[model samples]
Target: MEDLDVVAWIQVSDGRMLAVRSRGRDLLYLPGGKREPGEDDWSALSREVREELDLELDEATFRELGVVRAPAHDQPRHAHVRMACFTAAYRGAMAATGEVDEYRYVGRRERHLLAPAAQAALDLADRHGLLA
Candidate 1:
């Protein structure tokens, strides 16, 4: 088994966060993907968001949310994932770009719908008052 390192874009609006359902996964997660080797955080995030949601994020609007360590999706508990999460502003319409099957904006009340790691990250954003 190979370990996967992922970078996620956390889009917040009106105290809500964005999550997307993967093509074959049951649980929804933050919109992101595994980073390509040698790619920096900003580059990977931009590419992943474009690939997953067809949204291009403005680099200038990017804000570092935080990192979270949790069990890898569909993987064993011992296998952990280190997610480097970020928040950014975009001007395009939000839609699934085939990589994702569906999209949803999760507010604090709906945070339970997110995966544990994603929920933790969301909590951090809430504490910081980043969800505007």
Candidate 2:
């Protein structure tokens, strides 16, 4: 089986959590991406969030939320993804950039619209009282 190791930044406000849709993709995903070969969690997550959302994550403020695994989005059934998630303060307003085409804050009712990994993250956040 193939495994995709990636990082995600979990940003929730009010009752909604941040989600992004990549260009030409239908499902919304948590805001982060795959780590490069040599990058640690903070470095990789910060870079990915910056590239996708145009926000600078404060490395000093990062708090490890949790890790979640699920079948990989848009991949074969034998593939899976392991997402290392964190929450942190960020600088600047977030806007879609690069491969990101759109973004929205979604709640539990919208879980069906998210990719599997994102849905798992959402459930975890809700269980931890991170959601409204």
Candidate 3:
């Protein structure tokens, strides 16, 4: 089985975390993407955020969030994925690039628009007093 390694940015602002929805995908996902070869977590996340949202990651404000491993929700069961998540500050306008069609800040809800892993990150953010 092939492995996919990615880094996600958990961005919280105004008591909500950022979530992105692709044009046809039902589930919202944290803003991130796959890492390039030889890139570390921070570098990969920075690149992804820039590519996806046209924003620059504030490295000085970055923090290491925990990682998540699960079967690739979009791929076959034989394909597993590992996510190295992080939190950072950004100072630019938001735009949907790559696969993202829309973006919004999500708060606590009985049902999340995001996937399980993204929901888990929201849970963590809530526990950290970052969510409404």
Candidate 4:
């Protein structure tokens, strides 16, 4: 089976978690992406957040929330995605960038709109009382 190892930023505010809808995509996803060659979790997550959300993640404040694995959304059954999630302070206003088309703050009630890995992250966050 093929596995996609990626990092994600989990930002929650006012009882809702940050999510993004990429261009040409139907489901919402957490704000992060695949690591580049030789990049570690912190660096990859920071870069992805900067590129996708136009925010600078404060690495010093980063905390590993949890890791979630699920079948790769829209991929073959043999494909899987392992998402390493982190939460941290950021330095700028959030805005859609790169391939992102829209941004939303979602709560448990909105889980059906999320991708598989994002849904897992949401469940974890809610179980840990991270979701307001």
**lDDT (tens digit, per residue) of candidate 4 on 1-132:** 778888999999997999999998889999998888999999999999999999999978999999999878865654889999999999998899999999999999999999999999998889879887
- TM-score preference between candidates 1 and 3, better one: 1
Candidate 3 CA-lDDT value: 0.81
> Candidate 3 regions off by >4 Å?
1-3, 77-80
Instruction: Report the C-alpha lDDT of model 2 over 12-118, residue by residue, as the tens digit.
Output: 99978899999988899999888888999999999999999999999789999999999887866548899998999999988899999999999999999999999
Tens digit per residue, CA lDDT, model 1, 1-132: 445567888887767888898888877798887778899899998988888888889999897878887767665633777788898888688789866999988888877677776877787778878775
| Candidate 1 wrong stretches, greater than 4 Å | 1-3, 76-78
Off by over 4 Å in 4: 76-78
TM-score to true structure, per model:
0.88, 0.95, 0.87, 0.95
Q: Which regions of candidate 2 deviate over 4 angstroms?
A: none
Taking the candidates one at a time, how many backbone clashes does each contain? 1, 0, 0, 0
| lDDT at 91, model 2 | 98
Total clashes in model 1, counting residue pairs 3 or more apart in sequence or in different chains: 1
Which TM-score value belongs to model 4? 0.95
